[model samples]
Target: MEKKRSFPKFLSITLIILVVVGAFIGWKAYQTFIGPSVTDKEEFFYVHTNDTYDLVLARLKSQGIVKHPDLFDFAAKKMDYPNSVKAGRYKLIPGMSNRRLIGNLRGGYQEAVKFRFANVRLKESFAALLGNSFEADSTKFNDILNNEAVAEQYGFTTDNFFSMFVPNTYDIYWNTSPDKIVARFHNEYKKFWTDERKQKAQAVNLTPIEVSTLASIVKGEALHVDEMPKIAGLYLNRLRKGMLLQADPTVIFANNDFTIRRVLNRHLTIDNPYNTYRYKGLPPGPIMMPSIASIDAVLNPTDHDYIYMCAEADFSGYHAFAVTVAEHQVNARKFQKALDERNIKK
Candidate 1:
């Protein structure tokens, strides 16, 4: 027996209910489409220079970093990020919002794989590192390393393939080309050698290549960084006195296989031109990749008269320097005893 509601009140209540239901549905839809849908976190996406906007958008959508490809296209057009995006490898994470993901792509937040070449002995290792980044032809790289014509064109001597490379960590894009990378390394090497370094080389009567060759030897022999200058002085003094360099690393370099636990008496008899035990001057090329510290040490050696050196029995990153043959023999005997105790033989 209740009275009927007014028309205005009835209409108001109906509209309010419809509005609430519609708002709820719209919210649910937005929530469902807001973030990435994928669950696998390890998979990554790579973008290249040749990728178009449509292609990038599709890749982002497939990777689950973006909720919709249309949203990326709209944002890319609005924000002008399409032209700004750089090519590289990017890790796509789930639940990443569209705006932030596009920002990452635009700003080029791609992970750079650090390539290090410390203590690398052969040219093949360099080729391998470059190959990983560029998918470069290893055969071509090896040919470049061995090609006398190319070496001469690059101002490198064909005999010393290892000398041309300096040891350092370089940040390289995953898609870097091997030819470009080799050129960059050569450029870095040139930048490190200033006019002052050239003058120092001239003062020591060493050509640029010879200086680097000596530096490579210093790098290999010096167990510690601080011992480089002293080692350089010992070798330089020997060279001045016209004595045999007799460097062990040179023999290893000539042999090409550096697996000898101890350089044997017979090993010294292998007559390659790089064998400093038989040759009077520096080897035709660098034996290993030289560190910058080692290069500087060769340019500015300590003013000592040391003509011979033997590793310290303690292996404390120091060498026992000797000015005469008797002292050298004593130091050598001490080193030999230490080696024997450690089960290392020569």
Candidate 2:
């Protein structure tokens, strides 16, 4: 009887030990899947194209995003995250669980980048801006912008294609292709030129691209928004009378020297198509991306007989306008004296 009692007691003890071990394992699994495994601070994780799962795990550990790498690895493998990794810029919130983080990453939830550009001086700079913002590099964007066939494919010529990008804030994905980026800008361009705007362009005797070209010159000339209309009017009058535009900004653009503060006689003789002095009318294309205010100014220019414009001698961001050559000479002299006094030689 004593031997029988001992055997039953031993079996009961073995059963209790197995139950305790199972309960402990269940608790560990629950904590790994449901408890917070991310760091206290929010972070960003990037998975580049062609990145391996091991690389992603290493980056997560290096970034200090995962508090328990071993536990995270166990959960990730169980959920098959290794086979479903995605490339993008991902936002990692604070105190997130391992299961939730892996789920978001595996599901390809990407955070958008806010893309904004204005006053870009050249296509190269524009390409560089795109490269810095997204996965596509400057070379890719440049190839698309410079390709005549690509430009023509989108109903634009290479010379005028720069005007297609309407400067504004846009929400874009980080991994967007270069072609898609250009397509997006083209769509926005179409939306920007409404029927009313087209009619206004017709009323001004200019096409949309031509207006954009003129608007760029006006934008370069005027530092104040209120002064753009008058400056645009002066140029329009010159264009109508078959006179040389003789815009100083065009000369600077032709020289390819944005640092030239004072336009000299030598800069006017560059013989480039962009030199308004040498050209009889508007330049071949825009010298820079024009702003919305500048574009509207060209569409609604001030009706006036002003034939010439010179920077004000008062050092204010304003211009002095005159209708006759004699009056223009006087204003030009005052501005010349001001430039001479400031020693702005170039």
Q: Give a tens-digit lDDT track for model 1, residues 1-346.
A: 9998667977889999999999987765444444453335445667877778777777766666554566557656766787886777776666765556667778888876677777766777766656655535677677777878767767887876566677788777765665666787788778877999999999888877888899989988888888898899888888888889999889988887677757878889989988999998998888877778898999999989889888888988688999999999999999888889999864
Q: Write one digit per residue (lDDT tens) for candidate 2, span 42-140.
A: 567788888888999998888888888889999999999999998888888788898998888899989888999998989999999999999988999
Give the Å error, residue 163, model 2. Answer: 0.4
Score each candidate by Cα lDDT. Answer: 0.78, 0.91
Candidate 2 CA-lDDT value: 0.91
Pull out the clashing pairs in model 1. Answer: none
Maximum-lDDT candidate: 2
TM-score of each: 0.77, 0.91
**What is the alpha-carbon lDDT for the whole of candidate 1?**
0.78
